[model samples]
Target: MTPRDGARISGHQYGAGGELCLEYRPDNWEPQFTGAMMIGSAYRLLSGESPSDGEVADVASAHRQTVAQEVRNTKLRLILNTTLLDILVEQPLLQAQPFTLDEHWFAKHWLAHPRRLGSPDAPPIWAAAPPLTEPRTREGFAIRLPDETNVPFEGSYAFLNTILTALNFAPALERMTASDAEMPLLLVHRGTARLYSLAQGTGSRAVYVYRTIVAPANEQRLSAEHGVLADQCVAIVGCGSVGSKIAATLTRAGVGTLVLVDGDLLLPGNLVRNELDWRAVGLNKPDALAARLDDINPSTKTIVRRLLLGGQESSASTDSALQQIGQCDLIIDATADAQIFNLCGSVACAERKPLIWAEVFAGGIGGMIARSRPDLDPPPYAARRQILRWCDDNGIPWTGGDGEQYSLQIDAEKPPLIADDADVSVIAAHAGRMAIDLLKGGATTFPNSAYAIGMAREWIFAAPFDTYPIDLVPEGQWGPDADENARDELGGLLREFFPKAEEAADEG
Candidate 1:
C-alpha cells in the first residue's frame, strides 16, 4: 500500500485499540502513524475476516491465510535485522571490516597470537598452523589455510566479514562453513558494498558518531596514565550560580568529597543561573545544590551547611567556619560578600589549604580569578597584592555597596574596577580551571597566578601584575596598633592600586 494509505489505516487501527501493531516502516526507517498493519493482519488471521472492510464468507478464510503469511514475512525481516546486529558485535573481524593494511596486520597478529578469543587465558583461534595467503587484483592478500593447496578469494569470508562488520554489516556475526563457496566469492566481487551500506546507514545521520563511539576509548587509555584521582576534599563557600556550577563541574569530574556551604534560601532571582528551580525556592541553597549534585554523581560525598559564614547567626564565626575549612584540601570563595571572601582566604591560608577567590567586576564587564596555594614558593597573598596594585595603577575604582557591595564608576574615564557582572562567570570558570590544574599538579610552570578577563575588550591576561607580598599578622611592623594599622595598610594598598585619573580636555 502507499505510505499515506498505510498511515491512515494505522491511525484507524490504533484509535480502535487494536493489538499487534507495526508502528514503524523499515524502508525509510520512519515511524508510521500507528501500527495498524500488524494489528489488522493479526486480527484477520485469527477471525477469518477482512479487518479493514469486514468482508465475510469463503474468501475470508483465504484472506486469513494470506494475513498469516504476511505476519511470518514481517517477523522474519525483524529477526534478520536483529541477527545482523548481534553478529557484528560478536566477531571482531566483522566489526572491523573494510580493513586497512594496519587493521589486517593487527587482526592477523591478534588472531594468530597465542591468546584466548573470549578470555585472556583462552587458546588462540588459529594456533593450528601459520596463516595461509592469497593475492587479490586490487584489495590485498587474505589468510590461507596451510593444508589446502588451492587459495580462496583474496577478499574471502575471513577478510570480508571483518571489513563488512567493521564497515556496516548488521548482525555483525555471520555463520559460514566450507560449503558456502558463494560467501567467499562475494567479498572480492562486491568490495564496496559494506562501505556503501555504512554511508547509507546510521553513520550518516549521527551528530557526533566519532566522539560518541571512539573518544571514550581514547579518553580511557589516556586517563589510565594521566587521570586525576578524586581523593581530595573540596569545600565550596557559596551555592549561588557560580558556586553551583563549580560544584557540579567538580562532581562530574570525579571529586571524592564536596562540602557545600551557603546560608541563603533558593529564590526566583537565583533560578536565572542556579542549577535548581522554583521547587527549590525557600530551601537552603547548599542542601538544594548538594542534592542536585548527588543526583548527577552519586560517588561524590556531599556535605551541606545551611548557615552563612561571617554573619551574626549561629555557627557564623570565623573560628567555627575555619574548623570546617581545615578538613578540606581546597577552598573556593564564590560568595559576593567581601567579608566572607576575606574570612575564607584567611582561614584557608592559616590551615595551609589552597584557596580560589573569584569575582565579577563592572556589572559583568570584567572579572579576576586568583589562586593561592601554601606549597607554592610565592603564596596567593603576593598575587592578591599584585592584582590590587594593578587595579590602582590602572585607576580601577571600587565603590562599596551594601550586602555583597561593589563600587561602580558610571564614567568610562574613571578607574577600572570590580563594578560589573561581566567578570563574575569569567572569573569563576577561570578560577575553577586553575584550581583543577593546581590539584592535578599541572600548574608547576606558574604559581600564585591571577587571570583577568575583560568582556568588552575580549581580552585575557594571565599573571597580569607583579607580586608585592603582604603579611597577614594581626599586628604589623607597619604600625604599633593592630586593627587600625591593618585598615590603614589595606586602604593605602587600595589607593596605590587605583590612582586618580589626570584631567583631560573635552574633544567635543
Candidate 2:
C-alpha cells in the first residue's frame, strides 16, 4: 500500500483503538491554530474526505505518512535500542547512584523472556528489583523498564515516541532515534536529559551523572590535567603485544602525540593475546595498533612506521625516526629485541629523554621495567651486562627455545621462559601498568626493579635486592658486625671464579 494509505489506516486504528489526546503547545498563537487545523484536515483525509484547501490537504496527507512511518519504525527499534542503553547505563548508575531493582520481578518475567538477547548464562542485568520511588534513579529506571510488563505497545517505538514527546520535548524525542548498534531507548532518554540539564545550567554536572556521581571540582581538576597532557608527546617502539597495549593505554591516558614503530604484521597466531581481532590479520602491526588506539581516543595523534629499526631497509629513514624519537618526552621500548633495546637506550640517553624499557619473558612470568630519568645519569651498562652474565651463568634460553628437553626443563623451572601466545595478554597488561607508573612517577612495589611472578606456582619476587642507588657508593660507609660473616658466604664462589685475580690483588 502507498505510505499515505498506510498512514490513514494507522491514524484510524490509533484513534479508535484507545482514548487518544493531541495537545498543541506552539510557541505562538498563529502556529498553534495552524497545527490544530492541520490535525483536523488529517482526520478528514483518513475518512476518505478531501478538505476545502487542496494544497493544505495534500500537505497534511504527506505529513501523516512521514509521522506514521517514523512511529512504526521506532516500535521495533525501541525495544532493541533501549535494551542496549539499559545495559550500558545500569552499571555506571549502580556505581554512582543509590538504585536497586526488583530482581524477583525481573527473574520471574524478563529473565525468561525470549526477546532478551545475549547469553542466558550471563549475570542478571539488574542486581535487585528497583525500589519503589518517584523520580527514579538513573540505573533504577534503566533496569526497571526492561521488566515492566505493561510497557506501552510492549515497549514498541510508536508508544515510546508518543510518551517521550508528550512528557518531554520534541528535541528530546528526536535524540531517542539512534541506529541498532547504538545504545538503547532508555539510555538515550537519560543522556538527552543530562545534555539538556548541562546545556541550560552552570555546565558543571557530569554528562552521565545519573550513571555516576561526579563532583564539579573533580571535573575541573581532570580538565586541567588533560590540558597538561594534551601537549605532551611520546614515542613507542616494537608494536608487539606489550607495545600495542602501551600504545592503547597511553592514548586513553591522553598522551597528545604518539609515534609507533614495528616491523611485523598481525597474524592469526598473534590474536591469542593481542588486542586486535581476526579482521586485523594481514595489516601492519604498527598501523593496526595505531588504528585501534585512535578508535579509543581520537584526539591522540599517531604516526606509524612499519620497518624494523636499524635494518638495511630502514637505514635511510632511521635518522628521521630517531630525530622524532629524540623530540618526545618519553620513549618506550617494548620490543624485547636486544638490538632495538640497545639502540633506543643509546639514543634516549644521548638526547636526555626519559626512556622506559619493558619486557616479558616468553610465558609472561618475568617482566622488567627500566626507566632512565632525564635528570638522572643514564642507567649504567653494568645492569645490562649483569643481565647478560646472569643469562650465561644460568644457561637460560631465549624465545622459541630448543625441542622438548629444553622446553621441558624451562617449563619445570620457569614456565614463562618459553614464548606462548597466552602470555601476551598478561605481558601487555603488566607493561601498560609499568609504563603508567614510570610516566607519573609513583611509589610502586617494584619501582625501577625487575619483578617475576610465577603464574603456575604463585611465587613473586623482586630481583637485585630492590635497592635504591645501587650504582652509588656512600662516603661514610660502615660495616655491620656480621659483615664479615656475610662476606664469607660469597668468598668461596668469588674465589672459584677469580682465584688468580684475587691472589694478584692480595700480593699488591
Candidate 3:
C-alpha cells in the first residue's frame, strides 16, 4: 500500500497519528546539495541558460536571505524548513536516490564530530552495516520538492529492524536489544540537504522523539552555505549608529576580515541607533563595535583603529589611517563626514576597488546607499556631488525640513539629520543588504549606483526605492593605489603620487 493507511517513508510505513516523517528515494546521496549544487539548480531554473558568476550569485542570494523559524525550544533555526528544503531540492542531484550509509560508517562519522550543540535525541535500537558493495539506482521519476512531513517528528524501530534483517544484520539487531546507549535513530534521506534522526520509545508500539538534523556551522563553500560573505575583507569607517549596525551585519554574513575605524568614545546618544548596550558607552567606537562583532562572529578577524578619518589634518596617523583603508578588499564609508568620504572614494576609484558609502538624512527623512566599482562606476566623490545636487534640486533640506525641525543634510555645525535610531537602523539595514549584494557580484562589471529609501511616517520623504544616477567622470583624479607600493616599513612614503591610473590600468 502506497501511503494508504499510514504515512510512507522510504522503506518504512507507519499507522495514522504517528510522529512527523520523511523518506528518500533509493539511490540519492545525502550531503550533495552543497552551495555549488544549489547554484547549478538555481541557474537551471533561470531557464537552462548558462549564467555568469554574478547571475548564479544573484539567485542564490535570495535563499540566504530567507527566514527560518525556531527549532524546538532553542535559539537555533530549523534547518529543513519547508521553504528552504523546496529551494534545496531544485538541484537535479537532490532528487531522491536509493542509498544508505553503513551503520558503522554512520556511527563513526557521528561520533567523530562531537555534538557541539543541538538536541541529543537518539534511537533505542541499532542496526549493523550492510555488506552490499553496490547500492541500487533508479530513474524516470519527475523532479519535485519533497512532500511536507508531519510536525512533532518521530520514527519507528520496526523500520530499523526490517532494514537490519534485509541487510543480513539480524544478529546485530538482536545485540542492540541488550545495548544501553539510547542514541536517536538517524537516517540519511535521499536527495535532501538534511539528515533525518529521531529518538524511539522502547516498547512494543512505535513512538519517537521530535529531534531533527541541523546545518553544520562550517558549511561556507558558497553564498548558499554562508550567504556569500565567507571570504570578504571589509573595512568600515565610522562605527557610530549607522556604521556599527552595518558592521554587525557584515560580520554575521561571514566576512573573513573586518577593519573598524572610529576614534571617538561611544557617547550616551549612540545607544539609540547602536547595536551596543549602555555597558559599552565609555568604550571607543571601534573597540566597542569590534567587541560586538567578535561576539557575532569570532572567525571574522577584526582590527580596530582609533583614528577618525578626515577628522585630522595630514599627519603620520592620517597616513597610517589611509593605509588601513588601502588594505581592504572593499571599503564602506559609513562615516557621515563629507571630507573623509571624498578622500576614501577617490582612493578606491584609483585603485579599482569597490566602495560602498551610506548615510542617513537628518531626522531619518531618507538615506542613500551608493557603491562604485573601479573603472566601471563613477568616483564616489563625483557621485556624491551629483546626488547632493539632485537632492537640492528636489528640495531636500540640508538641515531642517517643513518648519525647520527635520534635517536632510549632515553638515558639521548643523543639527542631526537623523535624530531617531529607528530611522538610522532602517537605512542601515538597507545599506547592509546592498553591500552584501555588491560583494556577491564577485568583481563583475555592475554599474555604479545610489539607492535612496525614505521613511513615509515622516511625510517629508515619501519615496519607496528611488534611484539617482551620477554622471560618469572618466577622468577624475583618484588617490594612491594601496596595491602598488605605498609605504615603507618605517611608515614613510616610498612612491610618489601617480595621477594617470586610468591610462595605466586595464578598463576591463
Predicted model with the maximum lDDT: 3
Tell me, by TM-score, which candidate is best.
3
Q: What's model 3's TM-score?
A: 0.49
Query: lDDT by residue for model 3 over 1-508, one digit each (tens)?
Result: 2333454322121234332112222222468545465445433434322255434222222221112322323221113333333443553431322222322223123211111111124431112222222322111111222255222233455654554454454433443354332333323334443333323234334323333344444454545734556777888887877888899888888788998887778768567678898868899988888778776766788998888565533467777877778778899988766556655765576566778887776555677777776665556655666667666677644543522122112355654444577877887887788788777765533354776666654433546444443444443444453322222311221112222343466453
Q: In model 2, where do residues sit more than 4 Å from their true spots?
A: 1-228, 363-365, 375-377, 380-382, 390-418, 441-449, 456-508
Cα RMSD for predicted model 3: 18.6
After superposition, the stretches of candidate 3 with alpha carbons farther than 4 Å from their true spots are 1-222, 225-228, 312-314, 395-414, 442-448, 457-460, 463-508
- Kindly list the per-residue Cα lDDT of model 1 for residues 347-374, writing each as its tens digit: 6655777788776654454566666666
List TM-scores for all candidates, in order. 0.47, 0.46, 0.49
